[model samples]
Target chain A: MSRKLSYREAMREAMHEALANDPRVFLMGEDVGRYGGTYAFSKGFLDEFGPERIRDTPLSELGFVGAAIGAALGGMRPIVEVMTVNFSLLALDQIVNTAAALRHMSGGQFSVPLVIRMATGAGRQLAAQHSHSLEGWYAHIPGIKVLAPATIEDARGMLAPALADPDPVVIFEHAGLFNIEGDLPDDWSADIRSARVRRQGKDVAIITHGGSLPKALAAAQTLAEQGIEAEVLDLRVLRPLDSESIAAAVAKCRRVVVVDEGWRSGSLAAEVMARIMESAFYELDAPVVRVCSEEVPIPYAKHLEDAALPQPEKIVAAVKEMMG
Target chain B: MTDHHAAAPPSGPVPWDKAFALRLLTDMLRIRRMEEKSAELYGAGKIRGFLHLYIGEEATAVGALHALAPDDNIVATYREHGHALVRGMEMGSIMAEMYGKHEGCARGHGGSMHLFDARTRLYGGNAIVGGGLPLAVGLALASKMQHEQRITACFFGDGAVAEGAFHESLNLAALWKLPVLFCCENNLYGMGTALERSESQTDLCAKAASYNMPALRADGMDIVAVHEASKQALRTLRESAGPVFVEYQTYRFRAHSMFDAELYRQKAEIEEWKTRGPIHTFTARLKAEGKLTEEEFLAIDAAANEEVAAAVAFAEAGTWEPVDDLLKDVMTPPPPAPRPGGGDAGSPPAAAPCEG
Candidate 1:
């Protein structure tokens, strides 16, 4: 049983289910209530769940994020929606320091069962301040689990396990995926771990996640038309990264090109490439390559922004280069 | 700029009954004695890491914590040995925590700046200047959402008021009307930086008032004043949907930490604040009122010293956590078996990490 849903609707359904199912679950963030959500993923949620669950918080990221951590510790499951990855920097101290460190620092007596969701990536032309992708920066931290839901199934699936796990989880929703429509399976068995092969082939593996997923798929299609088979791998879980899947992809297709919307210098693509070398070096036919955002602040102009990000043509070029 | 001086003599008689007055005096003595011993231990190299002594700020923790119910949550700053002790963490755990022993409340991992105990509902001795405020706000939000009648007490220094977290938390707690008692221990300086040097708005109560919360100022060197102020504030919080602010105007009698050079202030400055030391002034007040005799005072002093000594021995006898288990608490122990009402949802259904 499958039903068509926009990625945004799938996410909203997941949140609605989480709220209706758990008495302790509530949503709080800026404009989540009245303004429907910065992305409209939470439109009509307040009317459905009322003000108690769909809380509108003051513009205080550190305050609310930390408070969410506390609420988690105090026996409420809080889903904190930081408006964007740009604004999440203000709450990074709380997210990285307090929420992540509390369980370990408290010697296992406390765990922050908090889920923080924020829009990430640069396709929105929102410029450097609002459109940067920093999920890799969050993925760098050890205390919390990071998930980038690239597909409608992932958008439908990741939240339940994230909430069920007794630790802090950050879900990064790419600003580009909200309107994309796809079918969601009734039985969503997606866990908050492992990568999935969106398109299987034998010639090369294209590794990517979040907003880069569609571009990688497009690149794979172009490669297919040119008779160069490509396997597209979507890294759904960023932290506690499913290196095994990366190895499996490598074992199947010896060469890999990681496409990421973040910058080339110290990006999640770099981590993936490093892991591929570490785990599947012997299997590689050529050195692993990457197509990442240019190493500069994302510019405001459309052509420059597209050039700065990982695009379908760039992915095709990178993989074609890797395949040779 | 005004020169530093001790707070004036506390006015009026001991408002509390004799027994209660003696208990307050006893708690201040306990903190003062424990801190003195901790300083001595640091000299002996028994306790390492940042040791922030709450020596002169005893009245703030003892008085404010005494006003809260046992089940309430307490979030304290790094300089919170007094807060933990007054909140009923065994003195032994506190000492062992300072010594970095496994038997310590946080299993020795927290050191001096991160003492945490689940049983006492002590959230932490949060080291960041204004870090604990948001957590306190959340805990208060939890209580409010759950319809629990408990309040959350958050303690921080004057330096924290300058932090964005302090302002943000104040606004959130006030805007949401969460029941959080924000206790600002204005001990003149944050580490070496004096309050006046850092904050343009020196009046902390006015800052809290800007958040639309009622703010009260107390002489932190006077335990009775602190207790009275906290009680009044908490009463308002319980009656109204409030997040109250209490500024305990006090001073630290020692260097900010063991490593501090004390370069920011003069010796005369510390000497001036010591005259109004919580222990001595309270002792004098109790003595003048005949509520505490010199012999009885000596008994309390003797008891505190004995307790701190035993704590040091317990810490000395404590053992190290085997290095093999370093990653034990990094993630939670997996959740328990599901109830019949729930679906089995956790545990990533792929190859788990660290397993071959």
Candidate 2:
């Protein structure tokens, strides 16, 4: 039976389960072993899985990620945790050029069943270098599947399906959602396709994902208090977006607000808005609005940090404006 | 090192009867001819994109590929026309791929630098330096995990050795004891940057040895030597533990690609290497050994020319993929599902995050 757990605990449980079930599955990253995860997601895994499986690597992202890709190619299920999205830039080539493109390039003869998990999004006031969301960049690639596990259930269940998938899958764990706790159903399984409706409303639809899901939901609650019911959609799979669900929500609500943690320009939110315009424009009663993070480097100061990101107030304001 | 003698008696000198040798010669000649035609085609603006000719590199691919079994996997770089031809991919399909026809090996999706034939287990004609190494490692890993008696041979130029992927792949192959043959073709130049200028340690075997894997070097210009060395190395890899690295000291007589201006090295250096060209040197050796005659060489050459003519015709007649299916194969379409959230319009489910 599934029980209530925090996003951190759910992710830890998934890793623990994978290590216990598969002899080939292992964890490797900068602090995935003795130091637990950098976010303490795998706090007690080192003692459970031992150093061999729960390996701690040097501060060489390219070396270790390439090694992980190698290890995956070599018959092991390597879950490489690249401490933060900012640092994953060092290993970008291996992920983009090698891991993702190998399968189709091989004429479907080879598949890299590798899973890479990295912390993304900004809410902790960690300055410019640390606070960027680049999951959309990965989603732009063709061969790999990109997943953002926004909830506890997704954190617990996504790893299994990801490991089972025959292609490389990149999982982005929002830095802001680790402590958020929720009830897990007795039979819970999170599919890596389609969007999950977080809140039901008919007046306006609030579409978002990753770290922004919580803020969107909070704004939906605030909107509910003001008697403006907002439908909240959590986009779990970023690459092959569940456009049907999104289109359905837009058709019903007729007004939409996209809440994205990424910058406004060339954002995933932009893609969603474009899709809406292309498919559901005639059904829309008002123009779709977007509440994206300010088009600037996420600042370190508390006030500036709040100002840089999409907040519940911003979502509330966007939804109210859309309702009008 | 103790010589682990062959378990089987050399497959009777590798079945290199007159017919087989002629076939080998014909195969190498076909690659040479097709590439020559491709160069002409590139000049005429019929074949666009980077066209890396496998002119002088033919014998290395023909020799080394002949040593491998059909079940074994092959991963090669952009300059892989020879490897693709010798690995049993249909000549017509590869030619069609070069022409970017829909009937090509990769169905026109991948061009000259990305020829792929899954039926022959030719993984790719990868353009990215060192990109195919990790893929080869993974294929070998799958074979090992599945308890299949298969090896993956990855071919890249010396330039790929300088890539981090090369070192990482070497270490993983050694650590996991995967059956991989890392074939490095040291053609001396990574597109105008000579190996001496790019690499700090010129001895590539020394670098591979750092991973505790056995490494060998061969005269790539000599087809017999390459064949013998690769056969021995494959035997060692198959019978023993872990991966092996083979450095084939080769030279490319043609420009790096069709676009090269031929300004990188001196004309004298080119003439010097051409003296040891694989075809001329091997044909001379075979004639000296009385294994082949001048008339037999001509017969093989005529047969290769005939095959190339037929392949060109086949490519010319190939079809293009319909524009309607341009977005196919991006993702496997998902199965139909019942609409979630109580078939739509059910009160927005209380801002709940997805459950595990």
The best candidate by TM-score is: 1
Give a tens-digit lDDT track for model 2, residues B260-334. 998989999999999988888767766766778999889888888888888889988998877776655443333
Query: Ten-residue segment with the worst summed lDDT in candidate 2 chain A?
Result: A102-111
List DockQ, one per candidate, in order. 0.50, 0.24
Colliding pairs, model 2: A73-B138, A153-B355, A153-B356, A198-B351, A199-B348, A200-B347, A200-B348, A200-B349
- In candidate 1, what are the lDDT values of residues B17-127, reduced to their tens digit? 998988888898899899999999999999988999988888889998999999999999899899899999999999988898888888877888998988889999898
Per-model TM-score on C-alpha atoms: 0.95, 0.87
Looking at model 2 chain B, which ten-residue stretch has the lowest summed lDDT? B347-356
For model 2, the DockQ equals: 0.24
lDDT accuracy of residue A246 in candidate 2: 97
**Candidate 1 Cα errors over 4 Å, as ranges:** B1-10, B335-356
**B-chain TM-score for every candidate:** 0.92, 0.89
Local distance difference test scores for all models: 0.87, 0.81
| Every model: Cα RMSD to truth | 4.2, 6.0
